[model samples]
Target: MRGHDLINTCLPDELIVEIFHHIESKSTRDACSLVCRRWRRLERLSRSFIRIGATDSPDLFVHLISSRFSNVTTVHIDERISVPLPLSELVKKPDKGASSSSALKLHYMKENNGSTSAEGDFDSLCLSDAGLSALANGYPKLQKLKLIWCSNVTSKGLTSLARKCVSLKALDLQGCYVGDPGMAAVGQCCKNLEDLNLRFCEGVSDKGLVELAVGVGKSLKSLGIAACAKVSNITMEAVGSHCGSLQTLSLDSEFIHNEGVNAVAKGCPNLKALKLQCINLTDDALEAVGVSCLSLELLALYSFQRFTDKGLCAIGNGCKKLKNLTLSDCFFLSDKGLEAIATGCKELTHLEVNGCHNIGTFGLVSVGKFCKHLSELALLYCQKIGDGGLLRVGKGCKFLQALHLVDCSSIGDEAMCAIARGCRNLKKLHIRRCYEIGNKGIIAVGEHCRSLTDLSIRFCDRVGDEALIAIGEGCSLQYLNVSGCHKVGDAGLIAIARGCPQLCYLDVSVLQNLGDMAMTELGEHCPLIREIVISHCRQITDVGLAHLVKSCTMLESCHMVYCSGITSAGVATVVSSCLNIKKVLVEKWKVTPRTKRRAGSVISYLCVDL
Candidate 1:
C-alpha cells in the first residue's frame, strides 16, 4: 500500500540491479544499502571500486571487503584520511599542558587498540604487511591497486599481494618504500600487469627494474620511473632488451645518459610517447631516437641544453607522425631547429615553446606556413617573439582553437586583433603580463570570437572595462578571469553579469574599482554561478556579500581575502546563507572558532593568514 512497500514488492531483483547500474553516485548507493537486507546485498554486489585509509582497523577492513563488497575490483589504500575532517575538528586546540602530537598519539592508540600485531609501534598506524595479507585474502579478484605514501609497506606485503592477485593489471606505488625483492615478486607473479608507476620510490635500484622487465617482458606497455637515484643505465638496457612491446615511457633521472636512451630507441621501435627530464643527454641520443623510433607521436624534452639544431632536425626528418612536441628551457634551440620541425612534421597539432629566448618570428612564421592543421599553441617567456610572428600565424592557422601567451613583453595589440579576426573557432585564450595589449584587441575578440567560452587576462594594466563590456554583449562566456587588471571596474562586471547568465567561474581579484553593485548584478542574473574569487577588492562591503549569498543559493566556493570593507559578520552571513557552500577561504582575523563550528562537517573554512 505504501510507496516503499510497493517498490520493494513490485520491482524484481534483476530490475532493481538494472536501475542501480544507472545510479553513479556513491552516496546514493550507500543510502540505498541501508534501506533493507536485500538492498544491502544488491548494492554490495554492484559496487566495484573502494578507497580505504591505511589507518583504518585491519580486522574490520578485511571483514567488510570479504563479506560486504565481494565484487570490488579496484582498491586504493592511502595514508591520508579518505574523508576530510570538519573545520571545527581540524582547528580544535589541544589541552593547555598537552602537546598536539601527544593528543594525536592518544587518539591513534584509542582507535587502533588490539588491531595491530605485537611488533607494531608508532609506524604501525599505517598499513603494513598484515593489512596487505588481509586484502589479498579478501579481494583476490582485485585488478588495480594504488598505495600512496604507505611507507610501512615493504616487499613482503607486495609479494603477498602479487601471489594472490594475479589478475592485477595496474599498480601505482607512489612514495612507497618497496625495493628490489618486492618488485621481483610482483614481476614473477603478476604476469598480466601492463602499467606500473614507481615515482618517488627511492629504494628501488637497477636490479629491481631489471627483474621487473624480465618477468613482465612483452606484457608491460607503460612504465614510469622518476626520482629513483639508484636506477641507472643498467635498468634502461634491461628494459630495452626485454620489453619490446612498450609504448609509453617517462624517465626523470640525472643518471641516465646517451647510452641508455640509445638502447631504448634501438629496442622499442613501437614506442609512441616518450618524456625525458633532467638528463645529461646529447645530440647522439636524439639522433638515435629519430632514426629508430619512427612511430613516435609525442616527445617532450626539458632542461637539456646540450642538444642543438642538428638533433631536432633529425627528429623532424625522421618522425613524420609526431603530432605533439614540447620544448622547455632548451636554451640552444633557435628558429633553425623549429623551422626544420615545421617543414617535416606537417601533422603537428599542439606545440609549446617555453623559456627559449632564441626562438622568434622566423620559427613561428614557419609554423603558421607549414602546420596548417595546428589547433593549439603556447608561448611562455619567449622574449624575442613579437606581433610579426603572431600576425602571420593568425592569418595562416585558420583552425586554431586555443592560444596561450604569458610574459611575452614583445607581443602587442596587433597580434591579438589579428588572432581575433582569423581564428573564428577559438574557444579558449589566456594572456598574462602582455602589457602592450589593451581594449582594441579584446574588443575585436568579442566581436569575432562568438564561440569563445574561456578568457583570462591577468596583470595587463592596459585592459579596461570596455573590453569586458564588449565580451558581455557578444560571447556567452562560461569562465572569466580579469585578475590584476586595475582598469576593470563595477561597470564591466555588471555588464558581464547581465549579458552572460551562464557564467559559472569568475576571478576579479585585485580590482580596486569593483564594488557592491557588481556583486548585486551577479546574484540577480548569474544564478548558476558556483565559484567566485573577490580577493583584494577593497571597495566591496558586507552589504554586497550578504546580497550575493542570499540570492546565489547554489554558490559552492567563495574566496575572500584582503577586502578591507568586509568583516566577520559578512563571513558568517555567507556560511549561513549559502546552503551548498563547501569551501570558504577567508582571512584568519575575520573567522572565529564559533563561525568554524557553525560551518559544521560539510563546509570547510580555510583561514588565510594576513
Candidate 2:
C-alpha cells in the first residue's frame, strides 16, 4: 500500500513519452512497463533505445517487433555484462546478394563444451543462422549497428543487410576481424551513414579509409578511428579533402601526424571536437586547430609530452568558446598553460590534467575561481595536488558535480570534508586508490552530500566502520566501493544497511575484517541490491552468504573470490534463492555451471597491479 502511494502519478500519454526520453536504462523502462498500459506505450515511443546487458535473447527481439508500436532505435551491448565471443565471418561480395548469412558467422565461445580459458578449444565467431535470417527479413528500420568485438560479422552478410536497411546512419566496427574489403562494402552500401567508429579495425589501411572519405565525405559527421596503427597522412588528407562538414573526429593515436591536422584545418571548417592523441603534433598543429577549427569545443591532446604552455596558450587565445579540455600525460603544461585556460575559456566545464605534476595547488585555485560552471574534473596521477588545493576547490566551485582524484595519494581526509561541506551537488565522487582519505572524510560525505549516487574510496586503507555508517545514513547512495579497505568490518556493513536502502551495486572485497554478520546485514537491508562482490573476505562463511540470499531477492552477480568458506551448499542456495543469479566468481576461472533458474554466464574479475 505504501509502495503504491509513492509511485509517481501519470500524466498525459505524450507528456509521459517526453519524460521517458531521458531515461537511459532499458531495464528501468521494462520495470515501468508493469506500471500501466500508458507507461508501456510511452516506453516504446521514447527516443533513446540503448539496449544493453546479458539477457539479449533472440526471442526478445522477435517479441519486440510484434508490439503495437516498437520504437527501439538504438541498442548498445556493453562488455561489462554480456561478453559475446562470437565466431563471425565476413561474406565476400560474390555471394552477398544470394547467400543468407554469407560465409561470415560470429561464433561466441560455446563454453557449454567445457573449455576453460583461451587455452581451451577456442571457438570461432558464429551466430545462429536462423537469427541472422530473421534479422535480415525483419527490422529494416535499424539505423545504427554496432558490431563491437563481433569479429565474425563478415562484409558480405553486412552488405546484404545494408541493401535491405536503407536508413542505416551509424556503424561501429571496433575490434572486428574485418579488413579493407569490409569497409569498402560498408562505404558502397550505407549511404546515409553520419557516424562511423572504426577503432582497432586493424585490417583497414589508407585505401579503405580513402574510399570511405570519398563515399561518405559529405554525410559523415562523427568518426572515430583510434588505434588504427597503419594510418598515415593519406587517410587524414582524404578526410580533410572530402569530409568538409565533419563535426567530430578522433585521431588521438600513434599512426597519424600533423600533415593530417594541416589537411583537416584546410578542409573541415566546422569540426567541433578534435582528438589528436599521440600524433606527432607540435605547436604548429595547435596553430592550425586554433586558426581553422574555430567552432571546436572539445580538444583532447594526450601524449603531447613535448608540448609546452605556448601551444596551449595559442589554443586558449584562439578557441575562446572551448568548454572541455584534456591534457592527460602532457607533463610540459605548467602555470603558463593554466593561466591561458583561466584567461581564455570562461565557459570551461570539464578539465583533466592527469600526469601534469608541475602546476601545483595555485593553478587549480585559479581554475576554481574562474571555471565556476565546471561540472566534471579529473586530476588522475596529478601528484602535486594537496589538501589546500581541494580546500580551494571546495570554496570556489560550489557547483562542481563530479570529481575523480584516482592515484593522488598525498591528500588526506581533510580534502574529502572540504568537498562534502562545499560541493553539495556532487553526484559522483571517485577517489579510487587514494590511500590518505579515512573515516573522517566518509563521515563528512554522509553528513553533507545529500544527492551522492556513486561513491568509490577503493584502496583508501584508513577508512573503516565509521565511514560505512556515515555512507549508510546518507541514504541516497546507489553505488559504493570500499575494496582494499581492510579496516572496515560488520560495523560498517551495519551502517550501510541502516542508512542506504537504495544500494544496487557494492564491492567490499579484500576487506579482511568484514565477516558473515555484515553480509547478513547487507542481505537484510539492501533488498534492492543487484550486484555484490565480496571476494577474499575470509570471514564470510556459507552461513552469512545464505543469510544474504534469503534477504536480497535480486542478487544477480555474487563474487566470492578466494572466500574458500563458500562451499557447494552455499553456492546452491544462491543459485536457488537468488533466482536472477546470472554469474558467480570463485578463485581463478569463472565456472558458469547450472544452478536452478538462470545458468551462470561469466565469473571473471581482473585488476592488474599498478
Candidate 3:
C-alpha cells in the first residue's frame, strides 16, 4: 500500500468491487489493473471472459475488445489466439522449372491472390470477415462462443455471427471451417442455443443436422457431434425428433448403429452424460442405454466392437443413476459384464477398464463387493487381474482414492500388499507394466499409503533402493515416476531428495545407476524441483549438470535424453544456472557448437541424437 495509496480514496466502490471478486488471479487482476484509474475501471468491470485472437489487430482487436470487455460473456477465438503469422504469410507454390513465362506468371499470381479457391478462404484467417464483424457488432450480448483452430472462419464468418449474436448460448466449433452454411446459420440465428459443439466439422451432414434439429432442437442442452463422416441414421432420426431437451450427448461416429443408439435412447429421456466413440454398437445399443437412459450418469464406451456383456448387463440392470463408467477397447466385455455392473450399480464411482480382456478376478470381486461409493480406479490391460482380484478390490473399495495399474501381468506382492492394506484413503498410485510388482510390493505402498501423492513405478524392473527408501519414509511426494527402474541408483536418488521436499514432478528415466551424485542429490534435497526427466541415464555427467544448476531454483524443465555424460559444458551450466529454465533436452554429444549458441540464449536446447 505504499505507492501513494489512495486505495480508491479509501475503499468503497462497492468495497472495491467486492475486493475485486476475491482476486481470482487473471495475473492478479492484471496487477490490480496497474494500480490506478480506479483500478483500471474496476478491472475492466470484472472481465467477463475474453480470449480474442486469430492473430489480433482486426481494427485493434475489436477496438481492444470493445473498449475493455463491454460485458463480454465468453469468447475464445484460436489459431494459437495470437503471435503466429510468419510462414511468409502462408500462401506458397510456384518453385518449378524457371520460366514458361515464369510459369504462366505464377498462374496469374494464383488467380489474383484468391490462393486456389473459395474467395481465397480467409487466406489463413486470424479471425476475418472483419473479425466476425467486430465480434458480432461488439459482443451483442454474446453468450459463449469458441472457434478453436480458427482455420479462417467461414460460412461467411458464420453468417456475420448468426446475424449479430441473437443471444447465443454456447457454441464451440473446433477446428472450424464452418459448413452446412455454418450449421444453417447457427440454427437460424442462435434460437437460444444450449451448448452445441461441432468437432472436426466436415461440412455437417444429414442436411446440417436436420437444420440443427429444426432450429435449436427445443433449446438444446449439450450436444457434441464428433468427426462427422456424413452423420447418418438420418442424423439420429433428426436427433431423435428434435432433441427433446437433450442432456449431454457426445457421438464420435463410426456411423452409429443399433438404429442410431436406439434413436438416442428413445429420444433423450433426460439423458445424463453419454460418450460413444467409433460406434457400430450392438447389445442393442447397450440395451437402448439401459431401458432408455434411466437418468444415466456419465458413461463412456470407446471403440465398440459390437458391444457385449449383454450391453453391460443392460447398463447394470437399467442405469440406476449409474455413476461414471468407462470401458475402453471393449473386447466383447467379460467378467460376465463386470459382474452385472457390480451387482447392478451400487452407485459406482469413476471406473475405467482399458483394453478389457474379459474382466477377471471375478469381475473385480464384484467391483469390490458393490462399489461402496468407489473412488477412481483404472485397470489397464486387465491381464486376468491378479492377487485374488486385487484382494477383493482392496477390501471392497473403502472409498478408494485413485489407483491405476497398467499391463497388470498378474500383479504381485499380493496385489501390492492388498492395495497397501485396503486403500487407506490412497492418493494416486500408478504402477505401469507391472513386472509382477517388486521391492516388496513398493514396501507395501510405502507402509500403507500414508496419504500418498502420486507415485508411478513404470516398467518396474524390481523397483529398488528399498523402493526409494520406503517411498522417502512414507510419502510426501508430489509425483515421482521411477521410469524403467533399473535398480534405482544414488540410493534411490538420495532417498527421493531427502524424502520429497515437496517435490514437483521427477521421472528417473531409464535409471541405470543415474549419476553425477544423483544430480547432486537432486539439487541438494530437492529445492522444489520443477520437472526433471532423466532420460536414458548413462550415468549423467557434467558433474551432474553442475549439481543441477547449483541447487535447483525451481528448475522448470530438464530432460536428459541418452545422457552420454552430458557436455557442451553441461549444457552451459544449465543455460547459465536455471533462471527458471524452461526446457533443456540434451544429447547429440550434449550439443556444443559453442554450447549450441549459448544454449540458444537461455533455455529451450533440444539437440537429441539418441
Candidate 4:
C-alpha cells in the first residue's frame, strides 16, 4: 500500500498502543506517537518508555524531561557514548600534582543551546535544576536512573526524582558527574532504594556517605561506591557505625587502606559480597575484612597494584569460605596465594586471575591439588600459565564447568589434550589470543564439553573452520565470539548457523574473511539471532547486510565498523526493516547528506517516548 493508503488503514489507536507494549525500539515507537493525535493519546496510555537517550540541546533536553515518559529508567545520554569520556577516576591520586596521572579523568562540556547535529555526537546529557524538576514531574514511576557521565547534574535532580518516584530502587551516578550535594539529596529522599551503584562518583565525601548510611542502610542491600577520590577513613567508620546489614559493598583500594577496612570488618556483620577494586589497597585491609566480615563468599578485586603473594596469603588466613574470586590484575600473586586458597577455601568455584602475570604452573598445580571442587577458572593474559598449568588444573578440577585461558601465550595443544581428557562438565570456554593452541585444542573443547553454551576463540590463529564446525555440531550454544581469526571463514559461519539454533549474539568483529555467504547463512539458519558484530569484515556488503536485516526480525543491534560496503541505503534498509533495532554503530560509513538526514529522522523517532 502507498503511504496514504497505509495511513488510512493504520490500526485503531488502541491497537497501536497495545502493539507499543511489545515493541522495544524506542525511536520507532516514538515515531508512532507523532503519526496522529489519536496515536499520541494511545502512546500516553500505553506507558511505553524504557530508556531515554539524552542530548546536550537545552530545548530538546527540557522537552524530553517534561514529556511523560512512563518507566523512564536506564537513561543514556548521547554524551556518554558519542563524545567518549575518560575512565581515569578508577585510580587513586598520588600526593602533589599526581592528579594528572590518575587512572580516570573528568572532562565536562558546557550547556548547548541547539540540538546536536544528526551526526549523533553529544557531550553527556547534563541536567539542570529546571530539567530535574521537569523530570520529577514527568516520570513519577521510574525504577532505575543512570547519569553515568552527566557532569552538570547536581543534588537537586536527586531530590526532584525522590519527591516524585516513590518506587525508585536502582541509581548509577558513577564518574562524579553527580556530586555530594546530589548524592546527599538522593540518600535523604530515595530511602527505599535497594541497589545504589556510585562506582566513581568522586565528588562524594564522607559526610554525604554518612547521610546515605543513616537514611537507607536498613533498606539498602547492595551498595558500590568504588573509586571515590574523596572517600576517607572517617566516612568508612561512619558506614561501619550505621550501615550494619549490607549484603554487598564495593570499596576503592584507597578507601580500604585508611583503616576503613577495619571499620567494615567490625561493623557490617551481614555482608556477603565485596568488590575492592583499584590499585592502592594494602594487605592489612584484606586481613581486616576477613576477620571482620566472616561471611564473605564472593570477592572481585581487579587491580590492587600492591597486592602480592603475602597479601593473598592473608586472605587465605581470613576469608576461608570464599566461593567466587576474581583477582584480574593482581600482578604479584604467585603459587603461595593459590596454595593458601586451595588449602583454605574448599568451596572455591569461580576463580579469575585475568592478568596476574606472576602466577605460573606451580599455582595451577597447587589449585589442582587442593581445590578439587574448582568448577570455573579464568587465567586470561597470564602469560606464564603454560601447558603444565593446564595439565594440573584439568586433572585436579574434575567438576570444572568453565575455563577461560584467553591470552595465555604459553598454553599450547598439550593443554588442550589435557583439558579434553578431564573437566567433562565444561559449559563456557574462552581462549582468545593463545595462538599456539590450534584446531586440536578447539576440537578437544567440542569432544569434551558437550554441555557448552558460550564459546569465544578470538585471535586464536591456530584454530580454523574445522574447530567451529565441531563445536557448532556438538553443542547447543547460546553465545559465541569468533572475532580476529582470519582462517575461519564461510565454512565456520555455516557450521555455526546450521548447528547452534539458539545463538543470539555472534561477534565476528575484525574477522575480515567472513563473506556474504556466511552472513546469508546466518540469516537463514539463526532466526533467533539478535546481535552481530561485523567490525572490519571487508567482505560483507549491502547484499549480506540487507538480507540479515530483512530476514532476522529479532535483530536488535548490528555493528558495521570499517565494513566499507555499508552505505546509507543499507542503513535505510535497516530502518525500514529489522523493526527491533535499538542500536546501530557505523563510525565512518560515508553516509550521504540525504542519508544523514534520514538517520537524524530516525533518531527523532527514537529519542524517548512519553
Candidate 5:
C-alpha cells in the first residue's frame, strides 16, 4: 500500500488531532497543515497559543489569526517589528510640495506637550484600538493575553477586550500605556481574572489599583505592580481590604511604607508569597507580618536597609512555616537577625543572601545547627563567610542539594571538603571568584558527591586539570563550566570526555591550552554533547572543531569567538555536518557576507562579532 493510503487507513481524525496536539514545533505543524485540508483544520484547531507582532498590517493580521485559530486561548501581542527596515530605505528625502505623516504627527505631538494621543502615529507603527477591537470580536474565548510594550493600546482598546473576553484569567500589560481606566474596565468586566501583572505601566496609580482591587476582590490571587511610581500606600490598603484571597503579591515602588505593608499583613492572612523591593518599610511592617501572616511561606526583600534584627526576629518567631527566603543588599542585617530566623524557621529549605556583607560565620553556623531541612543555599558577595560557616552547614544540612558561592573570598578547600563529605545528595555546585578554592576542594567534591550533575568553577585561577580529572572519574556531570580557569588544559578535558559520556553542555572559554586532542576525545565519547563554548581557546584549530562536529551530531550551538585557528572551511564543515546546529557565534574576520548567507541557509541564528 502507498504511504498516504496506509496513513489514512490507520490514523483517524481523533488520532491525528491527538498527534497534532503533541507536536510542539510550529514549523513542523505548518508543514503538516500544507499536506491536506484536513490536517490544516486539525493543526489550526489544536493551536492554543499564537504570538503576533506589530509590524504586520494590524487589522488584517488580527482578523486572519483570530479566524484561523478560533480555539487559541493565549495570545502575546508584541510591539517589536517583525523585520526592521534598513536606514537607507527609511531615510527617503521629503518631497518639495508634500508633508509626511510622521512630520505632521511630530508637530501635533509637540503641540500637545509630547503626548502620544495622536491616532495617526499609531496607525502604521503600532496595533491601535481598531485592531484590538477586531481581535476581541474574533477571539471571545481568549483566556490569557500579554500585551508587551504595546504603547498604542489605550483604555478604549482594553475596555473592548474586557467586554468581549469575559473568561480571561491572566493578563500581563508590561510596558503598555494603559492606565486606571483600562484596569477599571478589566476589573468590572473580567470577573474570573486571577492573575494580573502591570509591571512597567507608568500610568497606573493608586486610584486605578483601588478600583481594580474592588472589582476583582477575592478572586485576584496574584498581582505584580513594579516600577509603577504612582502607586502608594492607598493602593496597598485597598488591596489588603478587598483582595483577601491574594496568594502572591510583588511590589517594587519607593512609595510603599510600614503603614501600607502593615495593612496588607493584617488583611491578607492567606498571603503565601510576598516580594518587596526598593520600599521604605521598617520593622513595624515585619512585626505585623509575623503576627498576622502565619501562613506565609516565601519572602524576598531587596535593597532594604532600615529594617534591623528586630524585624527578622519577629518574622522568625511568627512565620514558622517560611520555606524560602531571599535577602539582597540588606546591608543593615547582621548575624543576629539570621540566627533568629534560623532558630525559628526550621522549615526553611532555600536561602539566598546577596551583598549581605555583615552576615558572617556565626549566622550561617546558626542556620546549619537549626535549619536541618535546608536544601539550597546561595551566598553572593558575602565576603565575611569563611570555611567555618560552610563546614557547619555541610555537617548538619544532609539534605542539601545545591550550593552557590560567588565572591566569597574566605571560602576555601576546607569548606568544599566538608561539604563534599557531608552533602552526599549534592547535585549542583557553582563557585565563582572564590580564589581560595582550588583543586583540593573540587577533587573532594567529585570524590564524595557522586550525584553532582552541574558544576561551574569560573575565574578560580587555582583550579586546574586535576579538579576536572577527578570530576570526570567520579561524577557523571551533564553541565560543566570552567571558563577563565587558566590552569585547565586538554588533559583534563580529555579525561572528562572519557568519563562523562552524558555531558551535554560545556564552556571552556579562555582555556588557552585546550586543543585538537580534547576535541577528538569529546567527539569520540560524548555523543550527547549539544552545546559548547570554546571562545578564546587560541590553540583550537579547524581540525579540533571538525572532530567535535563529526561525532556530536546533536550539537545545536557552537560559540568559537576569537579562536584564530578556525577558518571558514572549519565553519562550513560544522554547518554541513551537524544538521541540528541552530546557532554559530564566530569572529567576524573568518566569515564574509557570502559565507554568512550560506551558513544562514542551514543555521537558525548566525552571529559574527569582532
Candidate 6:
C-alpha cells in the first residue's frame, strides 16, 4: 500500500510547509513535533526563536514564553536559570513613590554596577518589571532582545521594552538594570534600532547616552559602551553629533581621554571597527585615529600605557586603509613603531602585538620588510622576539596564515625552520611558553605545516613523542592543545590519534603520563570528538573515561580538573553514556547528585577542589 500511502496522506499545506523547512534542528523540530497532528501544526509555524532560561517559575517562565511563542522573533534572557526560582515571590518594585526622574538619577545604580548583588543568590533569577511587561505583551513579532544578568531589570523594565517592542532591531542590555529612563525609552521607541549593546549598563549615564544619540542615533549601526561608568566626553560629543551610520565602536572607560577620542574621530565618518580599553587614551587619542578614521579597518589598543612611539607613528602615518591591528599594553612601542608600520600600513592584514617590550629584532624585521598582505600574526610577551625576528617573519610573510608565539623566549630551532620554510600557507599555530622550543622545533612544524588546523604547544617542556609523531604523521588536526606538556605521554596521544583524524578540540591538561591509552586512542581516532580538557591528569582513570563515553559521539564539554583517578562509578559512566553531555568539570564528585537527578534536563556539574 506504498507504506500506507506514505502514512495517511493529506499533505499539501504548502507541501507540509515545504517538509517542515527541511527540519533544521531545534532538537529536530522537537522530534518532528512529536510526529503527528500535522507535524504539530508545522512545528508551530517554524518557530522564530525563543530562549527562556532558569525557569522553575520566573513567573511561569514568562507565562510560558508569552502563551507559547506567538510568532516570536528572538528572546534570550539567560544568565543562570536552571530551575532554582525562590526569591520570596519576586518581581515587585516600581512604586517607591512612583520613582522616575530617571529613577532618581539612577539611585546609586546598584552601588556602581561592578556587579555583586543578586540579592545574595537565594538562587538568583529575578526578571522583574512585571517580567518584562509579560515579555513585551507576549512577543508581538519581537525583533531580537538579550537581557543577561537581568538582576531585576529596572528602568521600569526598559521602559516597557521601549514601549512594547515596536519591531525592535537588536538590543542587548548586558549585565542589566537599565538606566537613563531605559535609554530614553530605547531612543524614543526602537526607531528600527540597529544593534546596540550596553555592556555593564550601570544605570547608563551621559543623560542616557545623549538620549540614545537623540534617539536611534540615526539608525545606529553597532555601539557597545563597555563598562558604562557614567559615559564621559559628553557621550562622545553626542556620538559624534548623531551616529552618522556608525560601524562598530567599543570604548572602555576611565573618563575616556584625548577629548573623548577627538569626539569619536571628528564624528564617526563611517567608522569601521574600533575597541579601546582602559581609556584615558593618549598619543593624542592615537593622533585622532590617524586624523579621523578614514574608513578605518579594525583597530584595537588595550591598556595604552600612555602609548608612545608618537602614538604608533601616527597610526602608521595615517591609517592607509588599515586592516586589523591590535596592540595590547603598548609599552612605549619600539623599533620606531615598526618603522612607522613598514612605512605606513600597506593594506595590512591582521597583526597583534601584546605587551610590546620596546619592540625587538628590528621590530620583526620591520614586519618582514613591509606587511605584504600579511595574514594573521600574534606575538605575545614580546621579550625582544629573537631567532632573527622569527627568521624575518618566515622570510617576510609569504601570505602567512595565523601564527601566535606566546612568551616568545627567543624562539628556537632556527625560528622553527624559518616557519616551516616560509609559512607554507600555515593554518593556526600557537606555541606558548616557548621554552627554547624542542623536538627540533616540533619536527619542523610537523614537516611543513600541511595546512595544519590549530595546534597549541603549551609549556613546551621539550615537546614529546617525537614531536607528536611529527604532528601525527603530518597535520589534519583540529585544535589540539598539549597543555603543560611535561613530556606528553601515551605516545604523544597515540600520535595525535593517528595523524589528527580530524580531532575536534582536545586539551591534555597537566599531562602526567596521560593514561587509558590516550583515552582509548582518542575514542578510536576522534569520532568527531567535541571538547575535552583532561585537567591535572593523574593518569586519567575510570577505564579511560569509560572508553571516552563509548566513543565521543559529539561529546560536549568535559573538563576533569584534578582527575584523582575517576570514581563515583566513573562519574556515573559519564552521566550514563554521553547523550550529548553539556559541561562536567569534576574532581570531588559524589556522582554530582546522581548526574543531577538522572540528566535533569541534560547534565551540568562543576565540582572542584582537589
| Clash counts for the predictions, in order | 0, 31, 0, 12, 0, 2
Candidate 2 has its poorest 10 consecutive residues by lDDT at: 103-112
List TM-score per model, in order: 0.91, 0.77, 0.38, 0.74, 0.90, 0.36
Summarize candidate 4's per-residue lDDT along 1-610 as a digit string, tens digits: 4546464376776677678788777788778889787777677667634434444443234444345455455444333554222222222345566654232211112233333665424432354555556666766776676666666667766667777876778877776356566667777777788888777677787778888778877777787876777777777787788777778888764545637767877888778898877565777777777666668889887777776677677667777778898887787778788778778787888888878888888888878777888888888788887788889888888898888877777889889878877988888887778889898888888877889898988888778899999888788888999888888899998999999888899999887778899988888888888888887898888899877776788988877767777766777777668777767776533445665665543332122221
lDDT pick, better of 2 and 6: 6
Quote the positional error of residue 506 for candidate 1 in Å: 1.0
Best model number under TM-score: 1
> Candidate 3 on 507-552: residue-level lDDT in tens?
9888878788877877888888888888788888888778777877
> Over the stretch 140-228, how does candidate 5's per-residue lDDT look in tens digits?
99899998888778999999999999999999999988878988999898989999999999988888889989999869999998999
Candidate 2 TM-score, true structure as reference: 0.77
Candidate 1 structure quality by residue, lDDT tens digits, 317-426:
99999999999999999999999999999999999999988999899999999998889999999889999889988998999999999999999999999999999999
- Which ranking of candidates, highest TM-score first? 1, 5, 2, 4, 3, 6
- Candidate 1 backbone overlaps, count: 0
Query: In model 5, where do residues sit more than 4 Å from their true spots?
Result: 3-15, 22-35, 80-123, 600-610
Scanning candidate 3 in windows of ten residues, the lowest lDDT window is 55-64
lDDT of all predictions, in order shown? 0.87, 0.74, 0.80, 0.73, 0.88, 0.80
Residues 371-449 of candidate 2: C-alpha lDDT, one tens digit per residue = 7778888988877878887887788788888999888877788988998899999999888888888889888988898
TM-score of 1: 0.91
Runs of candidate 4 with Cα error greater than 4 angstroms are: 1-50, 55-125, 134-146, 156-171, 176-194, 215-220, 253-256, 396-399, 507-524, 533-610
Per-residue lDDT of candidate 6, residues 1-610 (tens digit): 6557574376666776677667777888888788887777666776777786765235435654566557778888875755444322342345657546434323422322224556533322466676788788888569999988877779997888688897899988888867798898888988889888888888889998898788888898888888777888898888888888888888888877788778878888788888888646778887887877777888898878876889878878887888888888777788888778766887788888998888888877888778877888899999887888778878988888988989988878788889888988889888899898888877888898889888899998988888888888988888999899888899879888977888889999999988998899889888888889988898889998899779887888888766889777887787688878777776555456766688654434555443
Estimate the lDDT of model 2. Answer: 0.74
